[model samples]
Target: MSTAGQEEPDLRSIYHASGPWTGQTLYVAAHLGLADLLDDDPRGIGDIAKATASDEDALYRFCRALTALGMLAEHPGRSFTLRQAGRALRRDAADGFRDGVLLQSGAVFRAWADVLHTVRTGRPAFDHALGMDYFEFLAANPEEARVFNRAMGATMPAAIAALEHYAFGTCATVVDVGGGDGRLLASVLSRHPGMHGVLQDLPGTVSQAGENLSGVADRCTLVGESFFDAVATGGDVYILSRVLHDWDDDNAGRILRRVREAMPAHGRLILVESVLRPADGDLRSVLGDLLMLVVLGGRERTESEWAELLESAGFTMRQVWDDPGLATTRGHSVIEAVARAEADRPDTAHSSPPKAA
Candidate 1:
């Protein structure tokens, strides 16, 4: 009984304290626009409660908890002040995490709720929870699609990180496979004045991409099509950023081989993806790895696994540029690769490709 420091922390207590309860409280506050409401001036609980139509006593207690969490500051006469952390939740904050939070609470929440299904069957739970493919669901729901796009745009640090970490080596044309909203490609084109880019994704995504690429539109070609079916051809380099980890290896192989087929003899591949450590990986990488499993039935791979995948797809990995500062970005490295000579590819690699996208 006296082994206080040796006693393990109570898992259930930790779960109640930090898991669903805390997460949902913050989500509800964000959904209710509490941050924006408090942005102009601190307000009494009565006024805030009236604005949100929440019970006065209940809202006061909620704000109190938020104050304790450092998202708000409790003030005299039951008033509350928004804290710096709370300011980030404002709808218009450029670097806000609001969209990602809302997404995690909405469709992602629904899908992750069935993660047991994913773990048991070794398949994504998203399809079962949403009654369709994840991308298809996004296509049908415009509002949600916008949120997903914005949420993903936050991860475009990978684009900047890629450019700094790897040299394009005087490439002429760059094709972005599964590029979302064209933000990443736009960044690339802006960096290389002479380079042209091809942005390919679902038809809906391509439409959104056009507007985002206005600055570089003259140098960018927006193509709307599924990467699994075909990729646009005749580029010096192909970029697969935040794409591969969305599906199982078989489907990923299909995408890679499609790129291989489209690739010219001297083409290069730039994979902006996380390179996981076989053991002792960081929490962000591993949590994202789990997110892939629950939502897409994909996986984050170690460097060796990445090399193996590339080799099997008729390409060979050249170098993996690990950027320590990019730990928080979409992917930690830009994996450079080149098309393997057809004669050098494994005989088994040319067999029937994956039917799934």
Candidate 2:
């Protein structure tokens, strides 16, 4: 269809041509270890080929494309070096994002192809497309599992920073409900020497927690149980980090109620998640929202949505903290909600003494 003397371009045709252009380049870079090879200085194509054992012609083509994409820079004759865009490629760098990129490119890239199906059905496309749910799929698949852990690990620092500034105040114990491998718990206990932590998760997950928490073993008690089935009772603070986003509203409310039941009269519930803005203006939050829809059958929530969920679960939303640029490093920021403990329970506080006796 031609319009206004300009031929209408075929949308699908353009997509088809550019579809795998960048992805193929990333795959080539991953295979060649080009970033690691150029970690020192610029190198000619022949040296890079000999080091990675790649064909000279293919290596030259890959490097040229990467250079065009600004991921590499050409020096003198046939020599290339890492550009600013390629800094994340080095594995040993302090702020290296190589593992993060590799993980996204590996499993997530494959799963994201079914976005349309997930959108149509509002079910997890990972399960439908891969024939298994995410955790189950990762359990038996070690490479994918390692990638998942590394990807999660990449966000721990920001999460830790958020927890560091949060007001714990007079709380003696914290139970990390649905804590994955106890990373956040360990980080908290390391910061607060007086506080003790009870780390709870599924039996299969606890074994991994045992390995990850070896350094802080003395400060944490690891429990093996599903959050849906059981949780440790009576902690002053119940921390749910990155847990609620994996569930829908009803299920999320149930999880919050379970935590409330296990809390004391004056206890607090801390929910740490990336709070989604209600509107579509924020591209990052919007993309995260879509990701939740496609992969987890959940959605990134607005502050109001989170407040509603918590209130329905018998907790009042006390406050929400700003995550600042800390969240920008990763895709989302940390939002903490304080849940009131004695709202639903009537008999917790003893009646006041008769006129001060």
Candidate 3:
């Protein structure tokens, strides 16, 4: 499979050095908004440079690099056009990942520099590199926290995919625990007009949720609280979308227990998280697991691991619905669960309608 001068596809391109190098290049392009500049039409290097306040020649070479990577097309007269792959880098594309580029390439990228510390000590590298916990740093630096919030909110595509095959069933009210900025909840409420929703997160974070919930404002409530303490009660369903994986079993169990304590006899709890597999050959998820290790001291779990965690907190797994068309990162199964006692009990006469707490 060797080409004329390609040297079996070139070791440099597949090597560790090339991975981060490519990432940094994309990071820089995103930082400069190069794709956005060329979004509507082709642009010459000089124009893009002037718009981004970057050096012309340097910008040309950078655009050429992205062109080589198939993200952009270098047209005649030193102009470049954003290619199909490049459109995904746009700020407002449906599958836009621009915020992801900025967030991952910013503080998180720096935190990854100390990944060896996480490996050796089973601790988060973010603490080693930034001298504070990831959440704490976000709280102290409001701007970075906003970036983190947007980046998390950008997972709307994944969230939609995860819920595509799932339904709310009899759940009239849904509570989104650790719901950042209410994007998921708003979307969910929009889909189920009869359903009321509650968005719960840190006080600072929940305050921002109001903006995204304007359309569903009348039917939604925002609660600024920690899951470790309590969750809004009386909801027929509780959602932990991309939430539990942020912690180890100890903390995850605690949070589940809180949700369990709040659930009524007929309530359901849904967990949207990657259930790690041994033979999936999915490197993105593997790297994501590592990212969790280095940045948040969290790890992806297998189906059995999820079952174990749920059962430990007095919940029994009822069903696991997955969207085969979606990726594992965002398309994780809707792990449907109910209180173990609720299922084990012989009588079911105590069911009650969902009520706002």
Show model 1 residue runs off by greater than 4 Å: 1-17, 326-331, 342-357
Query: Cα lDDT for residue 161, model 1?
Result: 57
Error of model 1, residue 239, in angstroms: 0.5
| lDDT tens per residue, model 3, 47-161 | 8888898888888888888988888998889999888898878877777788888888888999878888988999999999999988899889987877777788777668756
In model 3, where do residues sit more than 4 Å from their true spots? 1-13, 16-18, 327-329, 346-357
TM agreement with the true structure for every prediction = 0.87, 0.81, 0.88
RMSD to true structure for each model, in Å: 6.4, 7.3, 5.3
Total backbone collisions for each predicted model: 0, 0, 0
Can you write out model 1's per-residue Cα lDDT over 1-357, one digit (the tens) per residue? 334577667989867777866777788787778998995466999999899989999888888888877899988899998999988778888778877878777788888788899989988899889898787888899888888888888768756555553467668999999998888888888879999999999887788777779899999888899999999998988999888988788999999999999998878888888888636537678888998988888999889999999999998887776655544444557787888784354431221211221
| Candidate 2 clash pair list | none
The weakest ten consecutive residues by lDDT in model 2 span: 348-357
Task: Give Cα distance to truth, residue 169, candidate 3, Å.
Answer: 2.9
Give one digit per residue, the lDDT tens place, for model 2 in 187-232: 8887688988999987776778876677778878888988887679
Model 3 steric clash pairs: none
